[model samples]
Target: MTDMRNGSVTLLEVAPRDGFQSIDKLIPTAEKIAIVEDLLSAGVSRMELGSFVSPKAIPQMADMKEIAAHFKGREGCRMSVLVPNGKGASLALEAGYPDLVFVVSVSETHNRANVNQSVAQSLDQLRAIVAEAGDGGSRLRVDLATSFDCPFTGDVPLDAVRKVAGEALVIAPAAEFALCDTTGRADPMTVAHRFEAVMREAPDETVWAFHGHDTFGMGVANALYAYSAGVTIIEGAAAGLGGCPFAPGATGNTATEDLQFAFEQGGITTGIDRAKLLDTADRIAALPGGKTASHLRIVPRGRAV
Candidate 1:
């Protein structure tokens, strides 16, 4: 794993899971597979394809197993799925997903609303899940949602975020920690300071990533700040598709295309083909009720603004 803190960055494409989960319309399984294929073809190596939660909770992800089957045994791509609990982890195991993302919100109110568990209770459940996956060859990634701000509780305290992240590391020492801007309310300075604080509090080898939303149009800026503050992995959605169904005032994630453009323009390599990525963004936007918040997607590539 290259140190993202050193300058090299990796963008984890989260559209298939985070994006699709929020859509009201059910996208066909084949269409979902096609989009995943296009993303891979466009040089996106890491992707969150779907989640393993109950269909009733997130009907949009009902086809998780089918979607997993389509990409089974794929090589050269790091595929992951969001698992909210032990049952979700078991489902992902059965579906053959190797990477699982477990979310624990920093806000007590948001955690209760999102998963019906307090932070302590969720960590207990997460510990059990990690134990159950012992020697199963599955890797876990813990995401701290509302790490910066929460809709229900306004600004989250830095200590609260650090505590959750520290405890999460104890449960899965090798787990990657993603500091999420759930509502896109994080400013650049705050983002830099908080991330620096997290790195200091957590294990030196712990991989830190950023997941930002574009609700307030600061998604890209916040991400750049995160990168400068030593975060290497950044997660985003194709065509800016995302939002928390359980979160009030939540909106789309930073557009993957836009992030790639920003990184490349700053002389940072993301290994994504700009032209191919743009084409894939168009395909994503063509889906039913699909739209993008990527500025580069709307602007011509060669045109000087």
Candidate 2:
């Protein structure tokens, strides 16, 4: 927990969950495992290992238990599993992940459309989840999705996003909170302004992270804006994987390679091996429809794969 306000940076690799789950073709479990392993080998210290929602809702994350079981106690790296509610949180605890991330959308329309729950309902679920995880000696984080703009409900009011984040923190009291631009509607100015506002209104030093999509092709710009605004932990996918099934035509996340490049070129140190990361991206590219959206793909650099 380095002081993010002190200019330290962290990147949470999100390809295994957010990246693969959006595509029509299901990436094999073995491949998913390999990707996670590869990312770890590349010096990515933290990763969004998997999600705990029902397989019916997101079949790609059905193997969460298996993945969680496999990642338990892997040295040096910390893995986080996403939980949608108390049930998912229980499953995460059962699977033995010490770190958990709970997601709640700020937009009512997006919340109902994504999880079939209202904002209040989702907060209530989060309270239960926090209690459950606390009983199990696990840590929890809350991600406020659609904090910027909502596809279903145009521009999401900043107040609504702030309120949901505050409720989540109150339930867990000390849980970390992240803001996500699910549909990638956040511009640089919007990202800077919103994140600054959240920092000002947050209770204590909130563990703030940014999850930005590349739908409007401004993912990198928004992320850079977030970085400039003092956000450290940035969630992104390898090979630019991930898109919203509900918000059709929305592009994938900011490519991990792209984000890394931005940080490295800007004189920021992430402790991640650029060559290894690019190699992993190439491995994904070799997969059917693994076509990468990152700029590194054109460089023809060699590492592995």
Candidate 3:
């Protein structure tokens, strides 16, 4: 059950869903499929393949069902989709995805802006989802967005984060939980403090995860801090392809290659082929209006593969 990199960190490739959704234009479904397949072939074992939100709201993910059907039985990769609400959850489950990521912001203002639901309403919906999924059926990963800071409101309190996460864990005790830096405004200290504190509140059965953005260029550092705080599952987008709707013109989620390079260098293996990962990233960044910003991609270093 062990491998080379000491406390190995697993990565969840989210470019297909998180990254592509940021681009204003709709990427062809075939291209989306190809990119996802390439990421898997590059040795990414976990991923956010797509989402089941209303196509009217996010035209980019309109073809999620088709994408799911294409890679239904693919081996060596665990893929999931973002489900905004009960309907999205039902649709994703019907499409054959048992791994579902349900997102809620700790900041009420951000929650309303992000999902049009108040924080309390989101918790109620999550309670329903946990009941529907049960203890052993669908795997639910609740993403507490804006855990560190909100786009509409600046800094979020640690107590508020713990409260929301506690409420969610109470609803889905066996489910995985992710603290997300939706605005990319988290410093390493806050990342560490929040994760360390929040982790203390969860049961031993809960799996901790970190989802960070790169808007302030602290994505990699924040992820490392989260990892040091005992989070194993880290989420990133290829070529840094996702941007928050609240922070326009800002960079996207943490880059997959950046994470791979950072973790591998720290003796924490990610199992991603560096060269192939970069090439895949390059191809994705080449898409029309595709936005990307990654340090390892720009600077040549000893780790360049």
Evaluation by lDDT, superior candidate among 1 and 3: 1
Model 2 misplaced stretches (Cα beyond 4 Å)? 1-7, 135-138, 298-305
Q: What tens digits encode model 2's per-residue C-alpha lDDT throughout 86-190?
A: 888788878888688877899888888888899999888888887887742236778888898888878899898778876776677777778898988789888
TM-score head-to-head 2 vs 3, winner: 3
What's model 1's lDDT at 40?
96
Judged by lDDT against the true structure, how good is candidate 2? 0.81
The lDDT, on a scale of 0 to 1, for candidate 3 is: 0.85
How does each model score on TM-score? Answer: 0.94, 0.92, 0.94
Whole-model lDDT per candidate? 0.87, 0.81, 0.85
Top model by lDDT, which number? 1
Give the Å error, residue 88, model 1: 1.3
Q: State the lDDT of candidate 3 residue by residue for 64-116, as single tens digits.
A: 88898998877899888888877888887788888888889999998888878
